[model samples]
Target: MQTRNRVAMSRRAFAGSLGALVLCAPAVARAQSSGVVRRNTSGFKLHNWQDHFDELGKGIIISDTNSRVMQQWMPGGEMFIYPTSVPMTDELTRRGYTEITFKDPAPDWTPTPSMRERDPSLPAYMPPGPDNPLGARAMHLSWQYYRIHGTHDTRKIGRRSSSGCIGLYNEHIIEVYDRTPVGTQVKLI
Candidate 1:
């Protein structure tokens, strides 16, 4: 009887301690974990594009690098997930928000200065075709040097092998390209 009472008390103590720990965490931690933001303002305030998903509507793309998934929120609240190759390093896929600056069907490929420095063997440029890294479609983002494009290698989809740009399968990118227009916002998280 004494042992049972002690066990009950211990459980209650653990529950109380867990509650306290959660309460003690910073508001930002809570906000990020919940993917919800609360604003308090009497004057003008800077808004984070990530927090206003609904306002952005159909053109919003949320890339979860950890999960290797690109979720597009279409107008009227319809969401679609496209498997993609996310970058391995934060430097490659910097966290931020940007809008699509341009869209190209079968975009030409050119190794960036940084890319060539890393890989000396890469050619200077390759015309849009099956051999091109930027497969069937590409969407350039306002974040300089970053893009969402299709891959010639379909096996790379849903993996972490990209230099920086997010990559989907050729056919999948065709679908995304058909739907996503220029000026669509993309948030890499």
Candidate 2:
């Protein structure tokens, strides 16, 4: 009876350790994949390359795939980072550089002919409202069929879910929309 109890305790201990390792695997893999090592320090910390922060702007959007976040740079180095939805394939968001061409409030959604052809189930047009995928506000990008817009499904804000569009929470969109103007530069890497 003593030997059996010892064996059971050992098994439980091993299982707990295994579970801990499994829970940490994703974070470990993400760090490995990005080649970014985060450390605690008391002094100055060097972030990304200096060139990435060289430019000054009132309207610049930087989308980082590895971190799954978007940083909006306002003039004088005011930066706001928000979680973003990204394309499944990097190719869609990898367009070297682009800019916001226009913006709309409660924008009506119309499926591009190509999108309609690709997804036969998609509606030809969806009026501006709750059912519209482009939630409360939208910023049309120079690239075809892509927009920085509010998403009805806030659950997808930090995930790789959109075809190519950059999605923000509805309230977040309203804040950004009020600040950003047409022709704001957008960089997705």
Candidate 3:
């Protein structure tokens, strides 16, 4: 009987301590872990894009570089530019996209090695570098081969000069690299 009483007391104490810790935790930690952001850099800093977030639903990704924006529509063949995002990392995991042939409609699922073979000049497929075609990070949409990647070409920051790929700046690419994870949704306009 005494053992049973002690066990009950211990359980109550544990519960009370857990409740206290929970209450003391920061609100940011409580935010959804579903988001992914750039890793190598310091904390991602972002500002609102003035556009209403309510109208957007497919998915939202902030630029990982400095202040810049590049939005593109897959089927519609249009890219909208605005200073909507800054170099802010998100804890966002996006849809899986392995680099394969750069087809408009991504080809069958394959590992991201074929891309390196296809563009042998684009440096070896390293994780985070100026030449890595995957850019600092890639936000994979439901689409197969397609991805929103950063570019070594600082000049292409606001250009739609990819074979159906969305190009981001280099530093911004790193910012995206830090935050994005494996299975996040991408709603490119």
Q: Best TM-score goes to which candidate?
A: 1
lDDT of 3: 0.41
- What C-alpha lDDT values do all the predictions have? 0.76, 0.73, 0.41
Q: Model 1 residue 61 lDDT?
A: 84
**Residues 31-66, model 1: lDDT tens digits:** 422333222111212234357565865468877787
- Give the poorly placed runs of model 3, Cα more than 4 Å off: 1-59, 62-130
Q: For candidate 3, lDDT tens digit of each residue in 1-189? A: 355434445888999988888776643342433332222222424433224233223334433233334332122222222222221122222222222222121112232454556566654424444455445555554555556666556666543344444566655545444444444333333
Residue 62, candidate 3: Cα error in Å is 8.0
lDDT at 21 for candidate 3? 82
Clash list (residue pairs), candidate 2: none
lDDT of 2 at 109: 91
Most lDDT-accurate candidate: 1
Off by over 4 Å in 2: 1-50
Report the candidate with higher lDDT, 1 versus 2: 1
Span of ten consecutive residues with least summed lDDT in model 2: 37-46
Q: After superposition, how far is residue 57 of candidate 1 from its true place, in Å?
A: 3.8
Give the CA lDDT, 0 to 100, for residue 176 in model 3: 42
All candidates' TM-scores?
Answer: 0.71, 0.69, 0.36
